[model samples]
Target: MTTTLECRGVTAGYLKERPCVRDVDLTLAAGEITCLLGPNGAGKTTLLETLAGLLPHTGGAIEVEGAPVRSGRPRDAVRAGMVLVPDDRALFRQLSTKQNLLLAVPERSRRSSALKQVLQYFPALEKRLSVDAGRLSGGEQQMLAIGRAILQRPSVLLIDELSMGLAPVIVTEILEVLRRLATAEGTSVLLVEQHVHLALGSADRAAVLVHGRIADRDSAAALRADPGRVERAYLGTDAA
Candidate 1:
C-alpha cells in the first residue's frame, strides 16, 4: 500500500521539556483508515497535532507523500494534502453553514463544485445553509465540520475524537462516510476516537497508545477479536 503520511521518532507537547507524546512512529496508507486508541491523556491529540504541523515536535520528522513537512507550519501541512478536524470541530459560530464551508475552497471557480460535492456527502447541511453554525444541532455541526474538511481535498485527514457529544447513530453515519471516503476517494485517515469498538469496526488497523507511548499495533480485526490485548495496552500492562 502507498504511504500517505508518516511520522518517525516524534516527540511533541506544549512544553519542550515535557513532551506529551514521545518518540512516536506511525504510518497512514492510501485508501485505509488507522484508528489510534488509548485511554484519556494518552497524548493522541498531541500526536495528531504534531503530524498535522499544528504543534512542533521536539524530535524526529514528519513526511507527507515522501516530502518532509516543516514543523509548526499548519499551512505547509495543508499544502502537502493534509487536513485536521480538531476535537472541538472549530467552526465559525457567527457564519452561516454555507459561508463556513465556502471558506475552505477559496477559488471562485471551484467553490460551486466543491460545495456540491460536500453536500452530496452531507445532505443535511443543504437545507441548513442559511443557519448560523452555532445554531445547528450537535450532529449537524459535526457534519458541517467534516464537510468543510472534505472541501480541502485532503489526501490525509486527521480526525480527533469524532464521536464526542454525538449520538451513536450519528457516529455510525459519519463512520460510514469515512469508509466511503477511503474506498471511493482513496482518502487516508488517522482517527483518534473514544468509541473503541465502533472505531475498530471501521478502521483497517489500530495502534493503542498508553501514557504517551504506543503499546500495541495490529490489524483492526486482530485487535477486535482479542479485546484483552487492547485492554491490557490501555491499562499499560501489555508487557506484563
Candidate 2:
C-alpha cells in the first residue's frame, strides 16, 4: 500500500507546556480509511489539527507522501494534496451550495467538473444547488462539507468528526461515500470520530487514543469484533 500520511512522535496542543497529544505515531495508506477513535478530551481533535498545520507541533514531524510538512503551514499541506474538514462544517451561510462548491476549487474552468464530481458523491446536493447552505438540514450541511473537500481531490483527507450531530441513516450514507472514495479514488482518509461502532464498521483500520496516547491499534474488524478490548483501551484500563 502507498503511504499517504505519516506521523512520528507527534506531540501538540494549545499550549507548549501542556501538549494534549503526545508521542503519537500513525500511518495512513492510500485507498484506505483509518479511523481515530477515543472519548472526549482524548486529544483526537488536537492531533487532527496538528496534522493539518492548524496547531504547531511541540515535537516530532509529519510527512505527506514522503515530503516533510511542518506545523503552521496549512496551505502547504493543501498544496501537497491534503484537506482538513473540521467538525464545525464551516460553510458560507449566505452562499448557495453551487457557489460554495465552486469556491472550493480555485480553477474557474474546472469548477463545473468539480461540482459534477462532488454531486455524484452527494447526489442529494444536485437539486439543492441554488439553496443557501445555512438553510440546508444538518445532514445536507455535512454532505456539502464532505463534497467541498472531495472537490479538492486531496490525497489525504482529514475529517475531525464525520458523524457528529447527524442522524444515524445519514451517517451511514456518508460513511458509504467515504468507503467508495477510498476504494475508487485512492483517497487516504484519516477521520477523528467518537462514534466507535460506526467508524470501526466503515474504516479499514482503527486506532484507539486515550489520555494523549495510542492505547490500541488493530484492523477495524478486529477492534469491532473484540469490544472488550476496545472497552479496555477506551476506558484506559488497558493501554495495549
lDDT of candidate 1? 0.92
Cα lDDT for residue 121, model 2?
92
Show pairs that collide, candidate 2: none
> How much lDDT does each candidate structure score?
0.92, 0.91
TM-score of 1: 0.98
| lDDT for residue 26 in candidate 1, whole number 0-100 | 92
Which pairs clash in the backbone of model 1? none
lDDT of 1 by residue, 81-165 (tens): 9999999999999999999999998899998899889888889889999999999999999999999999899999999999999
Once fitted onto the true fold, the runs of candidate 2 whose alpha carbons sit more than 4 angstroms away are none
TM-score of each model, paired residue for residue: 0.98, 0.98
